[model samples]
Target: MGAVRKRSSADRPPSSDRGRRIRRSERVPDESGGTGMRRPIWTALAGFLLLAGCAGGEAASDGQGRPDYGEIKSMVKDILQTEDGKKAIQETIKNDAVKQELLFNQEEIKRAVVQALTSEQGKKTLRTTLEEPKWAATVAKAMQKENERLLRALMKDPEYQAMLLDVMKGPDFEKMLLDLMKSPPYRKQMQQAIQDAFESPLMQEKLYAMIEKAVESALKPGQKEKGGEKEKGGEKSEEGGEGGGK
Candidate 1:
């Protein structure tokens, strides 16, 4: 050949490329579960947690109708590690679908959480229920499992599944869990709750020891119940009676 044919850059093999390249079609989903561009996993997880908390109870309906997002935002800020992460949480709180799912009117949920955190009753509840390390761990784990179940359900619907996968690819969904561990406000909150409990006349060291012993006794491996199925039957009777009353 008298003249060498010139090869275009597009014709170059990927293996010879000097810089890394990613597929445009492989970008992560937005907070609303819409896919287009890739985003951080922290962003995705923040979105997921916020959505899950809002969706999991009767509050979703009540919240969607009159959201106190400022409260929700404050709680998230009170609990997350970084400013970037807090911003992501705030943005998630502002999402419309989240609002509708939780029945929170815009930012009302945020305000409610903040209000709860600052209030005596809210602080007491957190101390009584969420302050225990073991219980906090349990609630966190259960909430995560529930969120995954919800995400799996979302994926079963053709459109939503594709969106969720995109979000997963952006960051380790587990990072959110890690961030939660690093939060100072939560640690303080838990410590305060434990202190409150310890101060109670009804919660002396011996009593606390006894309660722990009882719980351990009831949790024996392979046991259905400490008293077996009869206790379970009694619980059902109470539940049934309550339902009938309602």
Candidate 2:
């Protein structure tokens, strides 16, 4: 019987290696920049208020405190549904910089970010009962609402709306997202890309150079030892026998 053929590279599952080559590139980490918290200040502030308020209540003493999840969800839903909220979002989409980004890299940017936010692993860290979860469900729900809001806002920005519809329907959307994940730049975002990219290009370059220098210095001794081992192995073969005795 003929041996079973192995799956060709193209036929195999997508590579574990994902990058920011296409649409997802913006999401990737740029170690060249300073690392800081990627979370929005308002989110951090609200969390502080939530924890402080909770600490004063009976729920705080429970084995697991019940989150004011309904309140949070309502806030999120309100933000997305209200007229002023929608107007602010539309304004964001209308900003020249944001418009350029949306129009130029809309397809890739959306796919990478949405894929990262909605991925099984991404959602896992974001899951848990609201009682025990630290802003988990709230965060997820807010993101979902925000994305929905953005898509609706896109309708007003005809170029971006067209781009989104082009890539976000049926199988094309799934493939685009999967492609975004496998692309290097985007997967980096899942780790901590946003914080790093929020800086000037020159500063980012300097930071990366420092990191590279540190890594090289740390590895220099180990690399020398490996080089010595290889040299010793070469000498041993020369002192022993040549291949085919020639």
* Per-residue error (Å), model 2, residue 70: 3.3
Clashes of 2: 11
Tell me the spans in candidate 2 whose CA falls farther than 4 Å from its real position: 1-67, 109-246
* Candidate 1, 1-246: lDDT as tens digits: 323334554566676343333443335444566643344666899899988886776676887889899998997777786788788888997998876777845478788889999999988998898878999998888799888988788868988877767766666766775677679987788899999988988789778899999998877753765567888889999999999999
Q: What value does the lDDT take at residue 145 in candidate 1?
A: 81
> lDDT (0-100) at residue 148 of candidate 1?
93
Which numbered prediction scores highest in lDDT against the true structure?
1
Q: What's the lDDT for residue 12 in model 1?
A: 64
Which TM-score value belongs to model 1?
Answer: 0.17
lDDT on C-alpha atoms for all candidate structures: 0.77, 0.76
User: What lDDT is obtained when candidate 2 is compared to the true structure?
Assistant: 0.76
Superposition TM-score, candidate 2 onto the true structure: 0.19
